[model samples]
Target: MDFRLTDDQRALQAGMRTLLAARYPRERLRAAVDAPHGRSEVLGTQEGAGAPGVHGAAEPAVDRRLWAALGETGFFALRLPEEDGGAGLGLPEAVLLFEEAGRALLPGPLAATQLAAGLVPGAADGTRIVTALDGPGVTAHLASADAVLLLTGDTARLLPVEGGTGPRALAAAPFRSVDPLTPLHRVRELPSPARTAALGPAADAARLRREAALLTAAQQLGSARATLALAVSHARHRTQFGRPVGSFQAVQHLCAQMLVRTDLARAGVYAASLTEAPAEIMGAKLLADSAAIRNARDCLQVHGGLGFTWEADIHLHLKRAWVRACQWQSTEESEEFLANELLMDAAGENAPGVWWDTLGEENVQA
Candidate 1:
């Protein structure tokens, strides 16, 4: 199938790419990495007037200024209704904005805010807001949100955080994610006085996952591309055995494999973004997770020992990929889900004949 971008979509993508490249260049990224708190310095301030907690320990405070900037740019309101102070764009536009965010490795409560904006009353206008998701001990509930949207299960009332940021819970497992630029938080405790409201059975959750997965894939694609570039550049400069490292066939093969994976993953993500099917989205997520993780590893391999050192930025992509691979869903879980769906689609029955016999019959003596 021909998956061509419309003129408007192309324009939107170009604009976003330009904006991200200017705002989130490598210098800014390096600064964020070196910060004492491992968060974007632009988002360093706390929410309330009183003093915030230790900078480096907790989830880094939300960057309200950056949030406002994103909001003004119509990013937060991308998929919202025009009546709700949004640009009245659709999922496709949202995907483009998010893909840029992935590439830039932008941080904060973006996914949560985007999900909350339209569902929460006055949220679209960026007022009186609350947002949280299910993880670990947390069930599919919206105790803190003025409005809650559930993705997989039934909605329930969740406890609110006492002077805490949002819903706090423990991570189901330890995740050393690749994109350290985008921090991950484990849910520790549930909030009390769980206030809640029903938004009906909305597609908010599924859409959020699909968007997150596709955008993450795009980010991974960017990381893969960046890593490959870095590896090639290093190979050209670094010499071994009195020759450029790039001259080595092994290094050449690794670079070729990285390129192939990245291109295939990018295509999968783009295709998934154009579809609303849950299966396609899941498949895209699985393929992207594999591509990002493998590509990062290969890039590191290409860089040899230098890549393992802290000074090298290769670790950043590695960490980011690790975190994102688990977020929304793990690679293993997504693959299992996709397999089940495919089996069901194949009439939920096993093949009648042997694998080779089925093909052999078609070319038989007749």
Candidate 2:
């Protein structure tokens, strides 16, 4: 199938890339990391600084102004219906925006907000909102959200976590994630039902998982691309053995492998985004996750000792890739899903004797 993006899609991607480059450049990312709350600083602050409902000492504070700016720019309303104050786009456009977000190493309630915007009524117009898969205290929560969308297993609910601005204990968690830019929280307890009801699981859990997988794959693709670029640039500049390190055959091979993996991941993500099937999405997630982790390692190896230093930005991508690769769904989880799909597909088909024979022969050689 032809996977080329349409001209309109290309224009959208170009616009997003340009905007992110100008507003959320690398230096800005570094500054965000250095800020007091790390990635969470972008969320701004709630009233009653030390009160219970507010995020605790450990939570990474988010920058409120930046989030509002993002909303104003239509970043949060890209995939909703036009009637609901959205750009009237779909997953493909959303994927492109996410890719730019990944390259920028942006930190905020991006996924939750996007998902919530689509699922929750009236949330499409970039209202400050947050949703959580595991409920409060997780990676994405609406601590200060104007509204909170909760996906509790087979049920969905829209609840008001707080009023206007006040400290409220949504959830709590023990350990923090490596990507401090996207902080995870733990919900200590569930509050009263300010507005709560079970919405028939409007979307399949599998579909939601696929959405997470695809969006994450887009992010990983960007990370892998950025990392590969950094490694190649470093190789071309760093001198070794009286020539640039990139002149070495071994370094060239490493960079080549990195490029191949990045391309493969990108293709997989694009394929997954085009479909609604869960298995296809799982495959995409598996490919993207593998590519991101492997490419990051390969990139780090190419940089040699310098890549390990704190000053080098390679580790930031490495750490973020590692952390994100394990989230939404682990590698093992995706593999199991793929295995199940394969088994189901083979259930009614005649066994291929030749395939088994080939496998048996390979085993015998071993």
User: Which candidate has the top score in TM-score?
Assistant: 2
TM-score: model 2 vs. ground truth: 0.82
- Model 2: worst 10 consecutive residues (lDDT sum): 357-366
TM-score of 1: 0.75
Error of 1 at 320 (Å): 1.0
Top of the candidates by lDDT: 2
TM-score of each: 0.75, 0.82
Full-model lDDT, candidate 1:
0.59
Residue 109 of model 1: what lDDT? 45
**lDDT of each residue in 203-271, candidate 2, tens digit only:** 444456567668887888888888889889989999988899999999999999999998888888887
Residue 43 of model 2 has an lDDT of: 33
- Give per-residue lDDT, candidate 1, residue 319: 81
Q: Residue 208 deviation, candidate 1, in Å?
A: 3.8
lDDT of 1 by residue, 192-237 (tens): 3234344555645555656656666666666666677787898899
